[model samples]
Target chain A: MTTGVRRRMGVEERREQLIAVALELFSHRSPDEVSIDEIAGAAGISRPLVYHYFPGKRSLYEAALRKAAEDLAERFEEPREGPLGARLLRVMGRFFDFVDQHGPGFSALMRGGPAVGSSTTNALIDSVRQAAYEQILAHLGITAPSARLQLVVRSWVSLAESTALLWLDGRRVPRAELELQLVHDFAALAAVSAAYDEEMASVLRRILADEPSDGPFTDLVTRLVGLAPLPGSV
Target chain B: MTTGVRRRMGVEERREQLIAVALELFSHRSPDEVSIDEIAGAAGISRPLVYHYFPGKRSLYEAALRKAAEDLAERFEEPREGPLGARLLRVMGRFFDFVDQHGPGFSALMRGGPAVGSSTTNALIDSVRQAAYEQILAHLGITAPSARLQLVVRSWVSLAESTALLWLDGRRVPRAELELQLVHDFAALAAVSAAYDEEMASVLRRILADEPSDGPFTDLVTRLVGLAPLPGSV
Candidate 1:
């Protein structure tokens, strides 16, 4: 190792550097598999310095978890100024990027199994989803979403999470194709919800009308129409 | 204890009895929580008798897992002599019943994490899904499904598993309503697939036409219309 002079950094900068190192380690392996020594070693610092920023491994892990969650939530806060379908596509692209950036950690957070995950990590993960739900409602221009709409959005998120987790577990097609398929599934589920409730129906109708003809939403609905039975046939 | 009646049974009967007893215990607790003595006691037999059927806890767990899979697969094999929607509803009803009957064990099996589950359990779980896929294909009268069809069905199964798992974990509405919602989701996914693939679209169109007006398929399609934007609106 080059024994160059270590640059003095601010407290926040040091903490950020530690968290970044921890995130990289945890991304490829479970938190249990990562050691504080390894993290410090990778960052060219001492274990005591690591504990100064984090009380222990759990805190360090949670810090990394939050950073990842914050990163994901911030990404989802994309510009909502475009066609609704285009906006959703951008949001989906962020979701894909999160998976690409974090790799196994993304799957671990999404899995939420008790062995390698803590309640704190799970809550952080939930907040990320909650952020997505709020962003979706904000995009839809609904300040206070109806209860049914809330459930619909939340269920879709869970579905998306499971699908992505399974894909990351090696049941993957091309990432682009799967992400597009996810966008279609989201639209399809919204349509299903609108079918059973008038509130949802109007909400979905308004959402669809906000999309352009060339957007993915149009492609999704148009395709569904052909699979639909001939008019009056049923 | 009154040791008056130990029935003379065949080897298969005795093994089945032991597995049934073990399954009852496993339904509420993971395999590690269920002791060999408890399983033998539950079966009204001695510890050595349990060992006679299975060498250890892992083997007993495997046997119970196989029994549950068999029971579920058999249930999905309902008579294929009805309206396609009716047949699908019956199959879905069986899926719901399996969850209800097996309870927590169903969730654990579907979760398939490394803690309590192994490669064997995971494979058994996949076999359960495989059986459903075959049953669905048989119901559709398609002897040889295309590659795309296989992916579509597998993905739908994964979605259904996630939905059921979330419901069982207590994010549930009324049991009947959620099951109906699941049926709708399945139809919607098929419609999504049909949009891009001509074979799937034709298959879905035919299936939709076979449903009665009062069925969930009709309700689902009808609801979708209200949510669908007018063709020229986009």
Candidate 2:
């Protein structure tokens, strides 16, 4: 009976409400197909009111993208107290979950992340990637990772993103299996980078030292370093 | 030049010509941006003539995609002689080269390879991926690759593709180093997969047995294993 009179939300709350509506619409439809009127109607607000908070559709889309990127960045941030592998797996699990929940919206934001957007939008996406890289390093307890360590981590991050996209686009394998494979790829890259970079060699030494001998990492090192009763054991 | 006296090309050649022109145009613009008129005009042909060979603009775009996919698939195949690592390095080199040449077009075709495209177009793209996977196994001489082996290779292919796209999108690392990193990834994955699948474990043994001393592969295994490394790892 009192439906005509609505409670007024603060500026931040209003902006967030609009973005949430826009994000949901964008998840189901391409950006071009989703209109401001639809967004306003979906939020039960006037078109002019939607414009008051955001200048235009592009800006609103950018905000939505940044929100997604922030969600991902936050998910990537975990306590760096656990064993590096377990910590990475947890982060990866959260990442997969985010991908599952966000599906199409995640694809829209990440597909051509920097390609179809402005430099500012691109930088926002880059920030998410950088945040993930830094979190992984922190989990490994590396305060000053070397150039090779940096490259390996950077490339591996790209690989993880690509894998995530491919999974969302295809008949995705089991999430646990995919997450395990990513960790294995990171470990492999660490060992591989060590072959070419002295800093990486030291990093791998630490990784090897931290790992249990009967673990997957240990078995991986054993298989790669075949004919070994465990090297660097002297 | 004999103006207005163009030589008559066969239907296949004419279609190839039209597709080539479309591919070049799509390279610099999105599929929606490139028009049927522009494609025909660019090829110095009439609009109806362009449509004569293809049903519509979407079909034309699909043809362009198929062309790029074929180009990439061709580049990934290489003579599978000599060391496996060396052979892989060669294939990666070609892949990087292809990416460098077709940066935008490659991205266009691959950005959503199977995402938004029609099933036929998606199938064209899938065919390329399947071809690359088969070629990789061929290089390894695996006639009947186990499920784990298939999974590892399939994931690696996805990784390679993602890396290529990232390289094109971002500041690219040096070709040799990036290629080496991929090789390392494949080798490491093989070892890791072996932990879960006995077939992979046996594959690693054969890989180890084939690698020669005083080579990069030998050095890699030694450095990864660390310590004495089985005296040249023979």
Candidate 3:
């Protein structure tokens, strides 16, 4: 544990170290503004070694973004066994906390740039979104998923991300107050699942009470009634 | 109109013409990709004249954005005499249609370089958001609004914008379906106002039943509960 011990590190450790340093620097300045030389200087390593780890600034930024996305995914995955609404709140609470702790880095990544606007980073975000959607479906016990369900999930995620950004932007509300408001908003939105079920049941009852149907109109009405709320409803 | 007649216009008409041309060009290309010279060329005017009108590409973009913001404000100011939920939906429907018609131009302004990052442009967006918030408060008959209410409106706006973008991205859902879903979702969220009022009413009833004294807790609860739901709640 001596100051000069200089413990040898693994290749993976060095790569992570480079990404961490790069993320820290990218937060204060735009990607174009930060140079590999500065990253190397900050990390107490030679420029060549930094290159050996990341190949270039673009690659480094993408890697950092991927790492952060993974971290977020893991956070959401942690509280998976609770009631649907409570679980969602827990996951969102963690997410807001992450934004608060890493405000600059999250903002930089969320505000994408040209160099890092590749399919890789997008797929990373999509993965997180898809995972959350699947969790909601499972919690709801939705036997057959529909396109409407997908839209709802996407909309909710979009709302959560935008709200986090606003909260980060020095909105006057405290985090606890924001969290309470979100719980109410999100829970009410989620209640649409029950409402949709009720509406569908009523449509079915009316159809059954009617004379034999002649066309596809009855089926269409049933399907429509069962459809999920649109994206961003919540 | 003859060519000469159209060409000879007042300064205000010419400035408007320049902004229209700039908005058109911005729709076709990223803001950074479009140049002042190109805007001038597209407008059938000299670069110096374009500069005389807009000063630079940034200024030109800002002007176009301001025009869009003003249009939105005007739409929001339209008569909203109806149930609160219906009124809110009508206003949002107008917004969605506007975004649909001006998809590319709005996208350019929202996600464009410098436009998204510029403080001035962000301020313009904030101002538009404030106007929308005010309209929501007026519709709900909520006096002395809380931060929570503002957050709800902001969240709803974000949701509406995100939904419009998804539709513009060519999602399979029809605009009619999206609109219906939004209405249902909004109605559900708006229902929370009733719950808030009910909670306050119960607190008052309890306070009055227990003692004749109006304690601070009773007064606080009374004030909280007296906050009515947006009109039209059962």
Best candidate per lDDT, number? 1
Clashing pairs in 3: A155-A232, B200-B225
Clashes of 2: 0
Candidate 2: where are CA atoms >4 Å away?
A1-65, A80-83, A103-127, A137-150, A162-174, A206-219, A222-234, B1-15, B21-62, B78-83, B107-126, B137-148, B165-173, B210-219, B227-234
**Residue range with the least summed lDDT across 10 consecutive positions in model 3 chain A:** A225-234
Candidate 1 residue pairs in clash (backbone atoms < 3 Å): A195-B223
The TM-score of the first chain in every model comes to: 0.90, 0.87, 0.72
Per-residue CA lDDT of candidate 1, range A25-68, in tens?
98998676789999999989899988988999989888888898
| Candidate with better lDDT, 1 vs 2 | 1
The CAPRI-style docking tier of model 2 reads: incorrect
The clash numbers for all candidates, in the given order, read 1, 0, 2
lDDT of 2: 0.75
Error of 1 at B55 (Å): 8.3
List model 2's recovered fraction of native interface contacts, to 2 decimals. 0.24
Native-to-model Cα distance after best TM-score fit, residue A139 in candidate 2, in Å: 5.3
Q: Which rank order by DockQ, best down to worst?
A: 1, 2, 3
Residue pairs in candidate 2 whose N, alpha carbon or C atoms collide under 3 angstroms: none
